[model samples]
Target chain A: MRIPLGRKIVTYFLLSTAALLVFMPTLMAVVMSFMTNQDIMTGSFPSAFSLDNYRRAFEQFSLMHYVINSLFVSIIIMIGQLVLSSLAAYAFVFLEFKGRDFLFYLFIATMMVPFEASIIPNFHTIRDLGWIDQYTGLTVPFFAMAFGTFLLRQNFKQIPKELREASQIAGMGEVKFYLTVVLPVAKTSLITLGVYGFLTSWNMYLWPLLATTNDSVRTVQIGLRQLQSQEQMNDWGMIMSGAVIVIIPTLILLFLGQKKLQRGLTEGALK
Target chain B: MTEAAATLSQEDYILFEQTKRKHRYKQFIKGMLFLLPSIVLFSVFLFYPLLRTIYLSFFLTDASGAPTVFIGWDNFVTLFQSSIFQQSIKSTFLFVLYTVPLTIVVSLFLAIIANEKLRGIGFFRTIFSSGMGISVAAASVFWLYLFHPTIGFLNIILDTFRLEKISWLTDPSWALIAISVTTIWMNIGFTFLILLGGLQSMDKYLYESADVDGAGYFYKLRRITIPMLSPTLFFVVTVTIINAFQTFGQVDILTQGGPQNATNFIVYSIYREAFTNYQFGSASAQAIILFIIILIMTIIQFKLGERKVHYQ
Candidate 1:
C-alpha cells in the first residue's frame, strides 16, 4: 500500500509549487504590508517592519468601525438564516400535508432568481421603508433562504422515521421532538449550514454597498473600497494592510470550521 | 392495526376515514405554522420584489423608481439596441467562458495531485483551498496591488525576464483578462475543496482492480477516475459559471467596468442603470434578461447532468 520514494518526491514538489502559486496573491499582500512605500517602489525587501500602515488603516480610514458593523450584520444574518431555514426545513421533512411538494418547489424556485436580477425592486422597497443606511436593510432580506432549507431538509431526511413515530407514541409534541430530537440528530449539518451562512454573509459585497451609505453602517468590504479610492497609488502598504484586516475574522472562522465548511459546500453544491 | 381494521364493521370504517381526514387537516395547519416565518419573509422580500421587477420592466419609471408611464416593451427594445447593454452581455459571456473552464481544469489538477498520500498532504490541502477565506473586495485589492501599473510584483517579474511590461488593469484589452485571472484564482479554493472531497471519497477498490488488471496510471485515470469524478465536476462547472455571471465585487473594485466598458458585466450594468442612472425600467429589463439566461443555463446543466454522468 506504500508509495515509492520517487513518486512521493515528485508529488511533494508538485503540490508545494501549486499551493504556493495558489497562495501567492495573499502571501505578497502580507509581505508588502510591512514594507515601506519607498521599499515597495524600489522593489526591495522591507528594511524595517512597521505598524504605520495598520495605524493609518484604522485611524485615517476608520476600518475598525467597519469591522464591527460587518460582524454585527453578518452575525444577525447568520442566526436569522439558521433559525428560519431550520424551521422551514423541519416542516418539509417531517410534516406531510396537501400541496406539500408544490409548496416546497415554490420555495426552491426562489434560488433561480438571482438577487442581482431582482435587486432594483428590492432597493426601491427598502428605500420606501426608509431602511437605507440601516442594519435591517442589510440583514432582513437575507433571512429567508431556500438553499439552507434544502440543505437541512436533506440532513433531516437521513434521520430514521422510527424516531419520529416513537416520539409521537411517547406523547411528544412535534415541536418538542423537533427541538430535542430532530435538531440534535442533524447537528453537524446544521452547524455546517450555519458556517456557510456566516461565510456568505461575511463575504457579501453587493447588497451592503447599496444598503448603506454611511461609515457607521458600512461593512469592511465597503471600507476597503473607500480606502482604495482615497489612497489609490501612494499608499500601497496601507491598502494591503486594510485588505488583511478585513480577511482576519473569516480566516479564523475557516481555520476553526474547515471540515464543516468542506462538507457544507460540497453537499450544498452537489445536492 | 391491520388485524383490528379487518374485523371492523362498515360504520366503524366510515368513522376511521373521517378521523383520518381530520388528522390531515390538523397536520396541514401545523406544517403551515412551522413554515410561517420563512413564508412571511419570502413573501415580503423575494416574491413581491420579483413581481414588482416584472411589472416595472414594462413601465417607464421616474428618478425615485416609481412608475411614471406604461411603456410596452420599450425598455427591452432600447436595451437590445443600446451598444453599451450589448457590450455588457458580451463581456459577461466572455467572462464566463474565460473563467469556468480554467477554474475547473486547474482545480482538478490540484485535486488530483493533492490526492496522493503524502506526509504533509493535509497542509498542502489547506494551502490550496485558502482563497475560500478571502472576501472579494480583499482579494481584489490584493490583486490590485499586484496589478498596479507602476510597481506591481507581476510586472516586476516580467521586467526581470526582459519582457515588455503590460498594463494589468488600464488597457481595455488586458483589463478583462486581468479580472479573469483574479476570478480564476478566487474560484480555485472552493472548486479545489469540492474536487478534493470527491477524490478522497472514491473507492480505493476501483483503483486496486485497475492495478490488478495491470493498467497504467493514465489509462486508469482516463477510464475510472474521470468517470467517477464527473458528478462533482458537473456541479463545480455549474456553480462556477453561475458565479461568473453574477460577478460584481471584483469588477467594481478592479475596473469599475472601465477602459471602454470592456468589463461592464451584466450585474454591474444593472446596478449602474438603476441606482446611478435612475433607469429602473431599463435595469429591470436587463435583470429579466439575465434571469432568462441563467434559467436556461440551469435547465441545460440539469439536463446534461442527468443524461451524461456516470454513477457507480
Candidate 2:
C-alpha cells in the first residue's frame, strides 16, 4: 500500500527526534567528560579536550576495581546461567516426568512477582547464611533464571522427537544425546540467555548494594553512585567520565551481542 | 518416509525410547536439582525479605537497632499523618500521574512511528533503546548537568528563547517535573521497544482488512491497533507502575528529596529512615507500606488487564 507523504515525513521527524532525545545525555556526557573542571563549573564546553577528568576518575576513585568486579560478576553470571538454565530447559523439553508442567509453570510464575516482595526475606536469608559482603551472595541468588529457562525450553521443545529417538536407537544414552544434540541445537538460545544474564548482573543495583557492604566487592554501578554521593563539589567531568567508562563495555557487548539478542527475540517472537 | 517408518517397528521404537525416556525423567529430576539453587535462593532472598519487611512494620524502633515498642498500625497511621509522608505520596502519585500515561502514550506513538517501513528504523530503535542500559542514578547525574541553572544546556536554550531560567533539581516546584521528564526519557525507550515488538508481531491482514473497509489511518489505529496492542500496553503499564513506585535512586542522586522535600518519593523515604536514620523498624514499616502499595497496584493492573485487553 502507498503511504501518504505527510505521514512519512511526520514519522521520520518523530523517530529522529525520539532518537536524539534518548541519546542526548550520552552525547552530553561524552562532551562533558573531556572538559576540565573549570569548563564543567563554568558550564562551558571545552575548547580543547583534556585527560584530567579521566586521570582523576582512575586515580582517586579506583574505578578499575569496580569495573573489574562488574566484569567478574557478569562473566560468572553468564556462565552460570548458560549452564544451569540450558540444563533445566533441556530437561523440561525432552524429559517426560510427572508434575513436569506444574513445576515449569511454577517457575514462570515467579517472573510475575516483583523483586520488592522478595527483598526483605532475602536479606534475612543472606544474613542468616553469613553471605553478606560476599561475592557468592551477590552471584548465587540470580544464577537460576526462570525467564532464561523458559526461553530456552521453548526453543528446545521445537527439536524433532525423532532426533532423540534416533540417538537412542543408535545406543546413545539420554545424557550423551542431550550433551551432543540438544545442547548444540539450542546454542543460540543459550547465547541469548547469556547476554540477558550478563546484562542483569551488570546493571544490578539494589541487591548488590544491600548484600555487599564491603567496598571491595562493589560493582561499577555502586562505585558510580558512591562517586556521585561523595561530599565534594559536583565534578561533572569526572562523573561523566565514570559514566562513559561504565557504559562503554556494555555498548561494546551490546554491539557484539545484538545478533544474539535479535536471533533470540525472533525465535521467541515466532511463539 | 512411509518405507522408513515401516522398516522401524513402533514396538521397537517405544522399547528403545522407553529406557531413554525413563533416563530422561531422571535427567529432568537432576535438572530440577540444578534449578533448586535458584529456587531456594529466590525464595530465601526475595520471599523471606518481603515477609520480614512486612513484619517489621508493626513495631517502633529506638537508636539501639531494636524494636522498642509494638505500635499497631501506628507507623501506617503516622505515615499517613506526616506531611512529609503525605508529600511523598503526593510526589510519587504525581510522578505516576505524569510519567505513566504520558510514557505509555509517548512510547506508543514512537513505537507506531518506528514500526513503519521506514529507512534507518533499526538505527533509531537502537539509539533510543540504548537508554535502557544506563542506570537511573547515572541518568539523574547526567541530567543534573543538563538541567543546571547556569552552565546547564537546558538553561542555555531557555535563555536563547527569552524564557526565564528554571532550576530543575533545586527548585521545589520544578524538581518533580524535571525528574519526571528525565524518568520519562529514560524509560520511554523501554516501553517503545515493547510496543514495537508487539506491533511487529501483528498480522498484516488486519490492516489490509481495514483498508478494504475504507478505514483511515486513525480508524485503523483506533480499531485494529489499539485492541491488538492492549496486551503489550498492559505489560508496559504494570512494569512502569512498579518502576515508578521504586523511584529512589534518581531522587537520592539528583535531588536527595531536597528543596523542601519536593521530590521525596516513598522508597526514598524508606531508604532514609532505614539507612540514614538507622530507624530500622520505621524504615521496615515504610518499606512494608511501599510493598503493599506495589502489591495492590500490580494485582489491580493484572485483574483489570484480564478484563480490558482484547487480543486480535
Candidate 3:
C-alpha cells in the first residue's frame, strides 16, 4: 500500500531524528576521544589532536591486562556455550524420549528468572567453590544457557526426521547421525549463539566486577569505569578512548552476524 | 540348509531384543545427560543461591562479621524503618514509570517507520541499532558531554531556538528526567530491533487480506498489527521491566544517584551497601527483597501475558 505524502514526510522526519538520537552520542564520543586534557578542561577542541590521553590510559591503568582478560573470558565463553548447547540441542531434537517436552519446558522456565536475583546467592556459591578471582567462575555459570539451547533446538527441529532415519538405515549410530545429519543443519544458529555469547560476555560489567575484587581479573567495561573513577578529574578523552577500545570488536561481530541475529532474536523471543 | 535357517532365526530374535534393551538404556541415559548441565548450573547457581539468600536474610552477623544468630524479621523491620530504602523504592517505581512506556512507544514507532518499504531503509535501520553495540556506561558518559551546560551541543541547539540552558543532570527535578532520556535513547535500539523483527516476521498474507476488505492503514494496524505483535510486545516489555529495575551502570556513571538520591535505584543501593559500606548482611537482605519484588512482577507479567499475548 502506498502511504500518503503527509505520512511519508512524518515517517521520514521521525526516522531521521531516531537516527540522530542513536548517532549523536557516538559521534560526540569519537570527537571527544581525540581531544586533549587541556582541550577538555577548556571545554573546546584542541588546536592540534594528540595521543597523550591514550598514552596516559595505558600507562596509569593496567588497560592491556583488562583487555586481554576480557577477550580470554569471552572467547572461552563462546566456545563453551557453542559446544554444550549444540550437544544438548541435538539430544533434545533428534533423540526421542519419554519426557522430552517436560525437559524442554523446564529449560525455558529458567530463562524467565533474572540474573540479578541469581547473583546474590550465586556469588556465595562461587566463593564456596573456591573460584573467587578465577576465570572458571566467570565462564562456568553460562555453560548451560537456556536461550542458546532453545535457539539451537529450534534450528535442529527444522530438519526432516527422515534424514535421521536414512542415516540409521545406513548403519550409523546415534552420535554419528547427530554429527553427520543434525550439526550441518544447525550451523547458522550455532554461529549466532557463538556471536551472542561472545558479545554478551564481552560487555558484562556488574557480575564480574562483583565477583572479582582484584585489578588483574577485570573485564574491559569494568576497566573503563575504573579508569574513569581513578582519574583526578574526569578526562573525557581517555574515557572516550576507553569506551572505543571496548566496543570495536563487538561492533564488528554485530555487523557480521546481523542477519543471523535478526533471525535468532525474533525466533527466540517469539513463541 | 534347515539347520542354518533355524540358527539364523534364533539369532535374529536375540539380536532384536538386545538392541531394544540397549535403546531403552541409552534413552534413559541421554535424557538425564541432556539435562545434566542445566540441572547442575541451575541448582548450584539459581536454587542454592536462592535458598542461601533466604537463610542469610534472617540471620544477624556477629562481632567477627560472620552471620551468627537468627535475627528473625530484624532485617525486614530495619528496611521499613530506613527512609533511604523507602525513597529507593519510590525512585525505582518512578524510573520505571518514566522509561517503560516511553521506550515501548518510541521503539515501536521507529520499528514501524524503519520497517516500511522505503528506499534507504537498511541504512536507517543500522543507524538506529548502533546504540545496541555501545555499552550503557559509555553511552551515559557520552550523554554527559552532550548535555554539558555552556558549550554542549544540546545548549547550542537550544540557544538557536532562543531557549535558556537547562541544567539537565545538575538540577534535582530534571536529573531523573535527564537520566531517563539517556536511558531511553540507549535502550530503544534493542526494543526497536525486536519489534522490527516482529514486523518483518509477520505474514504478508494478513495485510493483503485486510486490503481486500478495504481496511484503512490505521484499521489494519489496530486490528491486525497490534494483536499479532502482542507476543513480541510482551517479550520486550518483560525485558524492559527487568532492565528498568536493575539500571545500575547508568545511574552510577551519570548521576551517581545524585541530587538528593533521586536516581539511587535499589540495585545501586544494594551495591553501595555491600561493597562500599561492607554491610554484607544488609546488602544480602536488600538483594533478597529485590528478588522477591522481581519475582512477583514477573509472575504478574506472565499471568497478564497468558490472557493477551498470542503465540501464533
Candidate 4:
C-alpha cells in the first residue's frame, strides 16, 4: 500500500507551492513594510530594517484613530449580535408561541437576500435618524443577524428538553434558567458566532464607506482605501505598512480562535 | 353520585382549558419580548430596504436622492439599452466564470494534497488556509504591488526569465484577468478549509475497498472520491459563485472599474450610479437586476445539485 517515491515528491512539491503562494503576499507586505520608500520603489531588499514606515503610517495617516474606530464598531457589533441572537434563539427553541415556525422562517429568509439590495434604503434610514458619521450608524444596523440566530438555535435545540422542564419544576424562572444553564452549555457556539461577527464587521468596506465620510468614524478598511487614493503615485512602503496594520488584528484573532472560526464556518454546512 | 362525579370532571376540564389559554398568551408575550429588538432592526435595515429598492426602481429620482416623478420602466429600459450596463453584465458573469470553477478545482487539489497524513501537516494546513484572515482591502494592496507594471515583483520575475513585462491592471485585456487572480488567491483559503474538512470526514473504507478491488489511484479518485465529495463540492460552488457576483472591494481599490471599464462589476456599477452620480433610481434598478441574476443562478445551481450531490 506504499506510494511510489516520485508520487510523494510531486505531492509535496505541489502542496508546498500552494502554501507558499497563499502566504507569500502577506510575507511580502511585511517585508516591504520594513523597507524604505526608496528601497520599495527600487525593488531592493532593505540593508537595514527600520520602523520608519510604521511610524509614518501612524503619524501621517492618523492610523490609530481609524484602528480605534474599527475596534469600537466591531466590538459593539459582536456584543450586540451575540446577545440579541441568543435571546431570539432561546425563545425559538424553548418557548411555545403561535406563528413561531413562520417567524423563524421569516428571519432565515433574510439570509438569502443580498445586502446590496438593501444598502440604499438602509442609508436613507440612517440619514433620517440623523446618525450619519456617527458610531451608531456604523454599528447598530448590523446588531441583529439571521445567521447568528440560526447557528445558536440549532445548537440550543440539541440541549435536552427535560432539563428545561426540570428547571421550571424546581421553581426556576425562564430567565434564570437561561442565564445559568443554556448560556453555559452553548458557550462554544456563542464564541464561534462572536468571532464570525467580529471579522465580518471589521472587514466591512462598502457600508462603512457609504456611512462615514470623514476620519472621525471611518473604519480601517475605509482607511486603507483612503490611503491608496491619497498616496496614489508613491510611498509604497507606507501604504503596505497601512495594509499590515489593518491585517494584524484579524490575523491575531484568527490564530487565537482558529478552532472556533473553523467550527463556525463548517458547522451548518455539514448538516 | 355518578352524575355528580361527571359534572365535576366537566368543570375541571373547563378550568384546565382557561389556564391553557392564559399560558399561551403569556408565552406569546415572552417570545415577542425576546424577538423585539431583532425584529425592529431587521425591519428597518433588511426588509424595508428590500421593498424600498423595488419601489424606488420604478421612479425617477432627483439629484438629492428624492423621488421626483413616477417613471414606469424608464430606468430599467435605459439600463438595458446602455452598452456599459450590458458590458457590466458580461463582466460580472465572466468574473463568476473565471473565479468559481478554478477556485473549486484548485482548492480541491490543495485540500486533497493537504489531506494526506504527513509530518508538519498542521503547519502546511495553516499556511494553505492563511488567506482566510487577509481582508479584501489588504489582499488588494498586496496584489496591486505585485501587478504594478514597472516596479512589480511579478514583472521582476519576468525580467529574470528574459520575458516582456505585462501591464496587469492598466491594460484592458489583462485588467479583469489580474483582478480574477487576486480574487482566486483570496478565496483559496476559505474553499480549502471547507474541502479539507470534507476530505477529513470522508469514510476511509471506500478507498480501502477500492484498493482491494485492484483499482488504480485515478480510478479510485474518479469513482469513489469524486462522488463521495459531491456534497462539499456543491456547497463550495454555491458560495463561490454568490461571492464572485458581489465582488466589490477589490475592484474598487484596484481598478476603480477602469482600464476602459474592464473590471466594472455590477456592484461597482450600482455604487457609481447611486453615490457618484446621485442617480438613486438607476442604482436601485441595477441592484434589483443583480439580485434577480443571483437568484436565478442560485436556483439553477440548486436544481443541478439536487441530482448530483451525494448524501450519506
Per-residue C-alpha lDDT of model 1 across residues B1-312, encoded as one tens digit per residue: 877766686668889899999999999999999899999988888888888999999999999899999999999999999999999999999999999999999999999998898887878888888888899999999999889876998899899999999998989999999999999999898999999888887899999988899998789889999989888888788988888999999999999998899999999999999989999999999999988888877877777767654454
| lDDT, candidate 1, A107-189, per-residue tens | 86887888888898889889999999999999999999998998899899999999999999999999899899988888998
- In model 1, pairs of residues that clash are none
Report the C-alpha lDDT of model 3 over A1-271, residue by residue, as the tens digit.
6878887888888888878866877877777777876776666556777777677767877678888998999999899888778777887877777778887777767765667655666776788788888999888887778888878888888998788788879999877777777777777787888888998888787788777878767788877777777752557688778877787888788777776787788887664
- Candidate 3 chain A worst ten-residue window by lDDT: A227-236
What docking class should model 2 receive?
A: acceptable
Query: Which consecutive 10 residues in model 4 chain A have the weakest lDDT in total?
Result: A262-271
Candidate 4 CAPRI assessment class: medium
iRMS of candidate 2, Å = 3.3
lDDT winner = 1
lDDT tens per residue, model 3, B1-312:
999999999999999999999988889787677667777877777767676767777887643235787888888889879999998888889999999999999889888889888778888888777667777767776777777786567877898799988888788888889888998998887898899998898899999998899998899889999889888888799889888987888888778887788888888888787667766567778888788777777786767767754457
Instruction: Indicate the TM-score of model 3.
Output: 0.89
Kindly report which residue pairs in candidate 4 clash with one another: none
Restricted to chain B, the TM-score per model reads 0.93, 0.85, 0.85, 0.94
Against the true structure, candidate 1 has what lDDT? 0.89
Residue clash pairs of candidate 3:
none
Ranking by DockQ: 1, 4, 3, 2
In model 3, the Cα lDDT at residue A114 comes to: 65
